[model samples]
Target chain A: MANPTAALIIIGNEVLSGRTRDANLQFLATELGALGIPLREVRVIPDIEDTIVATVNELRARFTHVFTTGGIGPTHDDITSECIAKAFGVPWEVHAGAHAKMAAYYAAQGTEFNAARLRMATMPRGVVLIENEATVAPGFSMENVHVMAGVPRIMQAMFRALAPKLERGAPVVSATVHADGVFEGQIAEPLAAVQRRHPALDVGSYPYFRPGPVRGGVALVAKGTDAADVAAAADEIEALLVAAGGQAIRGEPRLDDNTTAKV
Target chain B: MANPTAALIIIGNEVLSGRTRDANLQFLATELGALGIPLREVRVIPDIEDTIVATVNELRARFTHVFTTGGIGPTHDDITSECIAKAFGVPWEVHAGAHAKMAAYYAAQGTEFNAARLRMATMPRGVVLIENEATVAPGFSMENVHVMAGVPRIMQAMFRALAPKLERGAPVVSATVHADGVFEGQIAEPLAAVQRRHPALDVGSYPYFRPGPVRGGVALVAKGTDAADVAAAADEIEALLVAAGGQAIRGEPRLDDNTTAKV
Candidate 1:
């Protein structure tokens, strides 16, 4: 069976405004890749209610599962929960269990559970609450849509809590063959031939350069669900590099790495 | 007038596959923001032809301008240039200037100008060439859509060269007030009131946490094209933080940054 598809929606004006760099996309992408769920696409959008609602509805129907981060905080800009409710066409109401937990925690701390704080407990009428390790407030899932915190730590915790329940697929494995001095132009033809040989596997030719000294090279990576096919593609690519008169190194290339006699 | 809006389309399967972390989105966002072009949305999709063509067509119509990166190389996986031509319903062919430049560069190095290498010179007909500082290959602009390299250095060079011709809008100014020990629940209500007062500005409340020692806080950021309104909202947020009984700092909070007397 084909791997279940996933999409990520980042609902934040801060990220787009460049005030903050997003750390969640990399984490989520790596985790989802390991879990064998292929992430099809990712959308980073501003914190607009209509945009969030529309994007959520559109992606949820197309992908097997949709995950959203950011704008779930307890402030004026935090409108993701309500927008999600609007997308599902459900009533946005506070969950009894979540409300009780937050109310007790706030009461113990001598803090008032005001309207804004109460918004954390409110979500779609029918949803499953995803547990959070960082705070009493929890993210919930409506249908195939999973809502999580924007903060990297909290989002990770929420994802970890919900990971066990998600459906799994075959994990994609990749192998890399690096030719430090062989630039992409020299090996493009042979690499294309290698790609044609293994149509099912993905062959990627990445040309990399180190800026300070102007030293450069290329890395060929083969990826597929079948480990044997990926391995065979990698071997062929390594041979292709050797035939190009460049030394074939069986790994990824770092920024400072450079070693080849011929151009 | 409102800022010129931009949308970024990152075309790469490696990025979506979680093999490589994307560094271009943050750089482009910050650059576009400084250039008075608010980036409204970003989509990271795999190197699929139809997806690229459709996304390019849809975004070019909705946004003031669109910038795309990756898949414009000399390999089988590099299909961006052709896909863009298909999207615009134009023929994809090698530009004379680009072809001459690449051919001369290869001739100087005594390298064969193979067909795979020639693919880099090909692009959609009737497009302006964007210069590349890192390599001989050039990126191009097709009407409102700007296509650039995926590599950070090359992409930045291409964008810097293209920036002078882009339409600019009002540069967004922002002010941040951080309350180190204050949680969002304590100040959400008052923050919402501040947001209501300054409806023209975007008031964001971000709660931050430090992992090692388990310390957390909140930061309120106010942003808008109008400088005076942003400052006014920031002042109100600082006062609100003070009213919440937390010390208000006048800058952004870093990971190791911790200064608070009370919670």
Candidate 2:
């Protein structure tokens, strides 16, 4: 089968206002990569109900799985669950399971569960709770859409809990050979050829800015599941770089290990 | 008047694959801030034309302006202009003005205008070109939707060109007062109170991770265009933080200068 496709929806006004630089998208993208699932798209919408409904409905129709990373808080702007319910035509009410969890949390803190805070317990019909280890309010999964918390810690915890449950393909494997003292344009053509040879692997070039304004090298990364295919592709790419008068540094075997752990 | 509202649609599948860490969202967010046009949301969708058209319609109905980046290049994935035209229900053809710009760019590069390259010149009807100083392919504005290049360097140039033509609101100003040795939960109540006091100004608390595993502290950022109001909110926020047994780091004065330059 093909790679499992996913999309992320980051909902908040704080992100767009420059009030916060989003760290969630980067985290989810890398994490999804490790799970052998390719994240296909991401959208950051505000607290608007109509916008949320429209985006969720459209994405659900296209992607196999959709993950939303905000607007599930206790505040009034946390309207994701309600809007999602409206979109799916599901009756939304406080989930008995989720409400019990929230009540216990508020009770433990010796705080009264106000009406506003109770909104956290509301969920779409027939959805399973994505157990939240960081907080009391659990995220919910409706069909293929996983609605998680906006808080980074909470979102991370929910993702960890859900990873094992997901259907994963052969995880995308990658190897990187770093090059120094070569311009990107000089190697773009040869890289294209390398890609053509290894249709199973993705060959990519990334140019970075270094000191002294030197024409810094490209990091040729080959991504796929088959180790032999990945290695062969990487070797072909490195050979081309060397032929183009650039040093291809074969560093540690674990050069792309972080990406492996990220998903 | 209310802040000039805008939205962004990032068209690409590469970004979602973790192959591309998006630089456009941050660039456009900061640019919109400088122009006093508040970017309320951002969506990254695949190369699907229907998704693009649907998103454009939804955003155009709500926002004062919509800026779409990517999908305007020579490749097959670049179909933003055609999709946008369909969204607006207007007949799209290669604008003579845009074609002239593309011809001049190809001439400068000493390359023939390949048929695939002409795709860049296709634009929606009744729109004016947003001059591309970095490259020959011009970005265009059809009604309120601005179609621009996806490349970071080119997007920045288009933004600079498009800024003067937009009607800006009173510039939004912000002040940050950092509190060391505090937790997010510890300050949530006081932050809420501060927000209640200054409804017009937005106050946000962001927790940072220290070198150690400990939660470093929260940065209390208050934003608004009114200098006096922002200052007042900042003063109150700092006082509250200090009272909560946290060290307050005085943030910079001007809010507009806080953005990181991309191009």
List runs of model 1 lying over 4 Å from the truth.
Answer: A211-214, A256-263, B211-214, B256-263
Model 1 lDDT tens row, A227-252: 99999999999899999888899999
DockQ category of candidate 2: incorrect
lDDT per residue as tens, model 2, B35-94: 778788888877778889988998899899999887776544457889988998899898
Report lDDT per candidate.
Answer: 0.86, 0.75
Q: Tens digit of lDDT per residue, candidate 1, span B89-153?
A: 99999899999998899899898888888898988999999986666888899999999988877
Q: Is the docking of candidate 1 incorrect, acceptable, medium or high quality?
A: medium
Q: Each prediction's TM-score against the native?
A: 0.95, 0.72
Q: What DockQ was computed for model 2?
A: 0.22
Q: What shift in Å separates residue B182 of candidate 1 from its native position after superposition?
A: 1.5
TM-score of 2: 0.72
Q: Which stretches in model 2 have alpha-carbon errors above 4 Å?
A: A1-4, A33-36, A48-63, A71-143, A149-154, A169-263, B89-92, B101-105, B212-214, B252-263
